[model samples]
Target: MWVFWALLAAISAALVIVLTKAGLKNIDSSLAFAIQSVMILVITWGVVFFQGNFHEWRAIEKNAWVFLIAAGVFTTLSTLFSYKALSQGPASVVVTLERSSLVIAIILSVIFLKEKLTWQVIVGGSVMIAGAVLISLSNSRD
Candidate 1:
């Protein structure tokens, strides 16, 4: 079930990249990101309300709130930078580069979360980074 959800999210992210690239053609990236952020806020809060989970917000611990807020800050920065990149470059190249953040996430998870690292993760991250670099370089030549 988690795999299914992750796959769906991956597909949605791919669509977002293409759609955002198209939408950024006639507008500033920051403005485009702001419009998208509004929709994100509405939909996420709507989900919480629909699920009757709004009240759970009050139950969150101080440490959890701090981490959540930090995550939100990073998410905003990541999206803004992604939008700016998409506006200035080919979607394929931009998305490949952005998705390479998976490597960073893997490293951070192992170090910060004390997660176990396996050979598969190491090989996969290396390949992914290589692919992103290749795509970025290929785009530069064109």
Candidate 2:
């Protein structure tokens, strides 16, 4: 089930890249992101209410709220930066670079979350970073 959700997320993220790139033509990236952010907030909360999940907000702990808020801040920055990049660069290259944050997340989890790192994780992350670097360098010819 988790794998299914992860695959769905990957598909949706790819669409977001292409759609956002197309929609950003001649538009200010920050303003474009603001509009999308509003839509995201509204739709997410609407679904929460529809699913009777709004009540779960009351049971959320203060620590959970704190972390979630912090995560939201990072996510906003990430989206803004990525949106700006998408507007300025090729979608394939930019999205590849953006998705390389997976490497950072793995390292951060090992450090901050005290997660154990296996050989597979280290090797996989290194390979992903290498791929991102390759994509980033793709159109840079003299």
Candidate 3:
């Protein structure tokens, strides 16, 4: 069940990126982001309410809330940067760099969460970063 949910989440995220790129062609990215943030927050809170989990917010640890708030701020700033990138760069290259958040996330996890640094992770992250650079270069060549 978890695997199914994870797969669906991945698919939905891909669709979101593609749709965001297409939508940005016709609208102000800031306005789009504002609307998306409101819609997502409402929908997320609705789910929490439906699951009778809204009350659980009171039980959330202070450290968790701190992390969540920091994450939310980071997400907003990241999206703005991404929108700027999409506006200036080809969608293919912009999308590739945006998705490189995985590599960034791994590095953050190692630093903040104290995750072990394995050779596989370093190699994989390096390759993914290289791919982003290559995609950007390819766009310039076209």
lDDT scores for all predictions? Answer: 0.94, 0.92, 0.86
Q: Model 3 clash pairs?
A: none
**lDDT (10s digit) by residue, model 3, range 57-104:** 889999999999998999899988887677667778888988899998
Give the C-alpha miss distance for residue 40 in model 2, angstroms.
0.5
Best by lDDT: 1
lDDT of 2: 0.92
What is the lDDT for 104 in model 3? 87
> For candidate 1, lDDT tens digit of each residue in 1-142?
9999999999999899989999998899999999998999999999989998888888999999999999999999999999999999899999999998999999999999999999999999999999999999988999
Model 2: per-residue lDDT, tens digit, 44-138? 99998889878788899999999999999999999999999989889988888888999999989999999999999989999999998887787
The lDDT ranking, best first, is 1, 2, 3
Model 2 lDDT, residue 87, Cα: 90
Q: Candidate 1: where are CA atoms >4 Å away?
A: none
Q: Which prediction has more favorable TM-score, 2 or 3? A: 2
The TM-score that candidate 1 achieves is 0.98
RMSD per model, one decimal: 0.7, 1.2, 1.6
Who is ahead in TM-score, 1 or 2? 1
